[model samples]
Target: MSDLAYSIVTRDLSLWYGEFQALRSVSFKARNGLITALIGPSGCGKTTLLRCFNRVNERYGNVTTTGEIRLLGKNIYDEDVSLIELRKSVGMVFQRPNPLPLTVYENIVFGLHIHSPARLNASALDEAVEQALTDVGLWMDLKDKQKSKATSLSLDQQQKLCIARLLPLKPEIILMDEPCSALDVEATRQVEELMLELAGRYTIIIVTHNMAQAKRVSHECAFMLMGELIEHSRTEDLFIRPLDKRTAEYIEGRFG
Candidate 1:
């Protein structure tokens, strides 16, 4: 794909935690308005790379990163970049759903409260809540239950709530790190369907160990091994004909 077509581009990205190197000269791109899956074994840099997009890894102290990561043509590490704004543009969903203890309505409007310069009135907040939940296909189910505590909902619902919360922020990209790890098969399917629906409206990059899930949900796939990106291509192409032997082996169940 052309450079202009990508939402995220990384060049020689490397990271270290204390003395341990977690990523090594990794370079890849996630296309705009498509789902890209990062697949690799445990200890590989898939999660680390995902976190780099919004500079979330910096939260863990003693972390250091080198090279460049550009989002929408702007270098994320540039001095002028505001962390708050960057996070707003690039939202993230963790492995397990983490809903605030507030009501579903409150959770949906939480980001708006933080980012909006002026306080939104009741009607506006109601519209925002409805729109975000509708975008995530949760409006009908939760519309009447908006007053319910978010933590009281099912795990799948909570996860969807987590995703719905990001929508009100108008994020250009969404990063998911093993988002379905805590859910069952049926719940996983539901979330994947939601992901398909969310695609094209928001660029999504997911880190998953389930190769089948990657093939099923992503438009493109990147295979990583021991912190290095071995191969990246269309989902079908990479699965059928990987450019590197390591990628082929990992796909074939030979090794991670």
Candidate 2:
């Protein structure tokens, strides 16, 4: 049932936290193998929408959701859908680097240790660690530091390791919520470059308040306001020729 060209599609998706609505009938398609950015002012529900893809919002109390979310054409709301598998397919990275307090090798193979049906031997685990680190452009720097604690690395390296951990899960979609918000300019740039390198193989959706970062890294962008998606299009069109007044106003810094 997969839509070969699109990795995620949402139809009339709405969510409420107790009596407060967080997302209001958001509907859009994020193309396969591309980076899609969700941008809005703080508290505008960009992160809420991003969490929807993996159903992480359900962990918050008194939350309710309605409508449909499809991943590769399969409705994720279907009763048989597995939350564990859904999360594996849609990995997430947060605003700040949050590496596990374990060795780099342990961090990389942690998912496999927990999720793999068959117990993998040491060689398989080693290969997985190397590949994941290499994919995130960290193997050369950290290959000999396998026993080092992941949290001891620099902020940018820790962020890269956070991403590297996800790769071992073989995710199809990666979600980032203000991923570079905690890093300095050079660190942010390194993470951005890493994102660009990872794009073609996985569908990436990022929630960011930084419009310039959105312009720099995303292929497509969606603008939201007051829990509603205002506009979505190619990054250039959304920034240079926004069709919605709200989008234009936000882009122009008139109001957010």
After superposition, which runs of candidate 2 have C-alpha atoms over 4 Å from their true positions? 1-3
Per-residue lDDT tens digits for candidate 2, residues 207-254, read 998899999999999999999999999999999999998899999998
RMSD of each: 1.7, 1.3
Error of 1 at 57 (Å): 0.5
Error of 1 at 145 (Å): 0.7
The sequence of per-residue lDDT tens digits that candidate 1 reaches over residues 54-155 is 998999899999999999999999999999999999999999999999999999999999988887899988998999999888999999999999999999
Where does candidate 1 have its weakest 10-residue lDDT segment? 1-10
Indicate which candidate wins on lDDT.
Answer: 1
Candidate 1 stretches greater than 4 Å from native: 1-3
